[model samples]
Target: MICAGDDDEDPFPVEDCLFAETFSQDTAFTLFGQELRIQQVFGGNLGVAAAVWEAALHLCSYLEERSVEVRGRRVIELGAGTGVVGILAARLGAVVTLTDLPLTLPQLEANVSANTPSSGWPATLPTVLPLSWGQDHMNFPSDWDLVLCADIIYLPETYPLLVRTLAHLCKNTAVVYLSSKMRKEHETPRFFEECLPSRFNVELVHLDGSQNINIYRASLRKDLSQDLD
Candidate 1:
């Protein structure tokens, strides 16, 4: 199923045809303390991921009251399927870098350009690039202050790659924010539970009143010695 941000110019027409929907009408959501323009898409088998995005947006609104040094912080988002989380962070004063597989870069950039109005991006808006997990380390400014991913831990085979990518990108005190719907039936929660805590201090933030969905926050443990093993 195609998520809401899938582009129309996908060259792999066969793979592109696998998705049922195209970019939907632009919808507005406030995430990470900034107003973001979003397109709701069909997650197909990844419906839970879409739900997680909704939950994160709700949490973002609630966190607005309490500032947490986001201004001018370098950030990177991995497996940015729909670019929702990354784009929102850019609006919230973080210098975000959005990445996904090369196939998804066009859609990702389209999403960024669509959300970012011509009035001009705050000098803090993010840059979009083709970053695949475990492919190669991105040569950027410095270690990221924050790394974000929404519903990225869906495949068990992807765990090792994600760990390596996160380790290379995050700073000593970097905080990584990940959100999911806890879809136990899909084995996603189990995948995260078994893999993430080995290197990060995983915390399940209860996204209760503000939104009707479940979400969590995982911050990297500063002292982890997780190796390439």
Candidate 2:
């Protein structure tokens, strides 16, 4: 699965294989006028959550193009794989928390440390934490101003859990920005069409036809917010 760089004429090059074998590599991205070096680990013990996906890049472009203001806001990125989105949020002045499974925390922390230097803006570094959706979401406070999710809605099994965690974290005026690749085979459409709307007021904010990716903005429905209160 995971192959080395192109230099090795390996048939299964790991440059962008979604489910490749065990290999380590670094890729660079330019966002918000800064170049970010993202280290990606494939296969070994990691799942598809190790590489930087196109959905993440698409979401980052959306943020930058729309000039979304994240300055001084409390932002948390759920299922933050390579920490790119959260790191960009930090670069744009938001206090960010990049969270994922415990197994992914080490790489996430390393990415954060690499992109966000000590002299970075906002004066505070992005916090990396271990967060498994719906299991221990209660441990985190429900006071985020913005919740960022990139390419997280793929597994149908995690739909309920993901929604529960979203409802628990997005309280008051908090909003969730989720970017997902629309794969027909996967249950991505069901999550956007039915699951997410059941709990939050979901809206289609942006759509990338070329990539079949959509960016959705969601917030706790009035009734859901009342129930949470």
Write down the RMSD of candidate 1 (Cα, Å). Answer: 5.6
Candidate 2, overall lDDT?
0.82
TM per candidate comes to 0.74, 0.88
For model 1, what is the C-alpha lDDT against the true structure?
0.60
Which stretches of candidate 2 lie above 4 Å from their native place?
Answer: 1-21
lDDT (tens digit, per residue) of candidate 1 on 37-116: 76544433323222225545544553464455566888777767568777766766678888766656666676788888
List lDDT for all candidates, in order. 0.60, 0.82
Q: Which residue pairs in model 2 clash with each other?
A: 1-21, 2-21
TM-score of 2: 0.88
**Which candidate leads the pack in TM-score?**
2
Clash number for each model: 1, 2
